[model samples]
Target: MLTIKRVETVVSMHQQLEQVPGCGRDCLGNCCIPGAKLPLYTFGIKQTLGSNKRAHTSSDDHCVPGDVGDFNDYEADDSPQENYFLDELLLAQWEDRMVRGLFRYDVTACETKMLPGEYGFIAQLNEGRHLQKRPTEFRVDQVLQPFDPKKFNFTKVGQEEILFQFGPSEDNVSEFYEKAPVLSSPNVVAINVSPIEYGHVLLVPRVLDRLPQRIDQDSFLLALYMAAEANNPYFRLGYNSLGAFATINHLHFQAYYLAAPFPIERAPTTRVSYGRKKGGVKVYELSKFPVRGLVFEMCNSLEDLSVAVANACVYLQNNNIPYNVLITDRGSRVFVLPQCFAERQARGEVDQEILDTQVNPAVWEISGHIVLKQRKDYDLATEEYAWKLLAEVSLSAERFEEVKAECLKAAFEGPPSDSMAQPPALPNGGSYNLLEKEQAVLIKSNIHKANSMDGVVPNVGEVGVEG
Candidate 1:
């Protein structure tokens, strides 16, 4: 029974936070943002991956803030200079917020270790993130719930929690601002109060728009841009749909710095043929992994990959399916996981033993980084146990095949016109859409199952509950 007040404290913490520096109010709402200042990192739109673009520095005495440099100056291209947006800027700003005592807990101090096994599943015992009570206004069954302003959302968050305003520059060069006026609808990165890992933050796109927790093309691209901007493989971003362990209905993506590779990253993938021309986006299926999922890798540009994944996400949301997304390899690779753990829990089909542990397998968990609430579960964690836990989150073979066909179609062909604007039904009507829409025929040749790894079991595992 997650009370409204408790959830409010978790998301907003209005009571704990001090007054806003300039506005005297405590929140990032329109009232306090009129004159509030925040560090801004503007990225260059012309900078493409692998391009020999000269790096732009704030120290360029001739260049002023918000000024785009002359393109002719960068023609020399001695070396492919790194983008001005690097891990250091993100980390430095993030650390400053940490020094200001903005986070709810020191996630760096949390106990995290890799379980001994073939896959080496990572486990984090983060009791600080444990919340037994369900969010009152949250309808766990629906993926596209309306944004309830009365409930907790990012707008109610404090300005101090925000690291910087991230967006594209006016010209072809990157620029940083010491204190820029907060935009009315800027994409901002804020700290997750209950941090699961070091440098854990939430990328809230166009916070003022108050969009529900559903994927949009522009927002998804921003997430990819943030990942690409960091240029670090260790910093991965993840998304959890409403019913897929996303407690909040507001639109956001969770990201953190994990030096070690996720178990899912090491999983083998077989290419899926979408009948598209080569040199675009390639779709693949996870092989020898506990949770069944689809992987998207870019062959052309980030926009291509973002469109494919965003379309797949839009498809799941319209169909009322719960899913998780992992944006890895600096946003070049993405894993779309269609899950039924929440639906199974709702119907009481989940195992009692699994429910007792209270492990909500969200994006991180499904990606083989299970965050355990119990010390016993952490201590007794094993490869077999981790496999069994994630196996339950995956859709059954029959359902997955059907979903895969539809998602691939959505990814390559784009979502259907009729279902594009369809809003999700209220909880009273039940979450799953009963009315059947035209289904995409499953192309058997498109899917190829890869060989399972040695010592790995072939059986599917099913178990689910809150984490």
Candidate 2:
């Protein structure tokens, strides 16, 4: 649980951190988002605090930190496709909860309590305070069109629209790309924003490595609550677990302007409550994480909003999911996504797994959906069959649990997959002689600060993550 002491420590740490100089050449301004479980998890590993502290930095880096018990889960190369390719590729899905990351984290209790002259680092965020109030309806004339996979063309936009690349430096690319026509775009604000999602919205921070997707928890929650109270239509906002959705890889949210009640919420689907979970939600108790909550449908005041935001935090603790949650009286929904994530979405189009079982590079992510990447093990002929097989396993509680159990076995650098038919051998056809290659060109082991740009773009015939 966060106390005055912990909050105070964090504030001091943040202040000290701000004093440091920027490292543009090697860093990206990736701000820590609110409620960063990974960093905290890393902290715990360093301190050897958790029951298991055995974690591996990479395949070779063993746990000197007493080996955080489950390192591979958060490791860089931890790909869901590599493990449960068939199940996920097979279209096996079930209803799950959603939580917006930083976008929703904009809300905080302190922010809601912000007075006219209550100036501070957080006070600066009150630029749009007046916008927040009793929820208002957004009436639009645009007809709604159901999302069709066919019409959904996920493609990249280059110089036409600025790309939010999380790179070391890209003066050449920036020189070629012109600012897009969007108002208040990040590229307009700064060139080095995050490349987390395909359709990234916010501008990358100028101070590389300073800002993280994880943010000030209280302030962010307050921001969301206030935003919800603004002249908008959405009733509730939500998020999903890491690695659960395609977007689970890089942290981001799908934002939409809430629309009027659909047919589902009306007659046959009168189950969902616009304001609250029906039956008072059983006070929604859980023992795993800490919680804070307040229901705001009763009062429309900021105080009520703050209290509600504070209370809603309990839901985070209760559910053990990092989130930015808020409830407005509106009976509509709202959607927000990365401003330039179109490029990211473009990669999702390759819906079918490749011969090697890589993910469809196009249309990678969207509300509650994940496009499993098909890679090496998934042969094209068997890719479809592979997807079907895995889908069945995921849908079945028993099989899903089994996969989960098996996944928990190997740490990032621990022994390879238990089910491995054979050891992951080096590429045949003399890919390279490791010893000779290293001798010819000096090589060192480092997870980060390595060939980031090289890794991001396609390498001579090598299909790149970004292309």
* Candidate topping lDDT: 1
Q: Give the TM-score of candidate 2.
A: 0.24
lDDT of 2 by residue, 309-414 (tens): 3333332222222332323222111111111112223455322433233322111122211233222231222323423322321213443233223222211112
What are the lDDT scores of the predictions, listed in order? 0.71, 0.21
TM per candidate: 0.79, 0.24
lDDT of 1 at 134: 30
Leading candidate by TM-score: 1
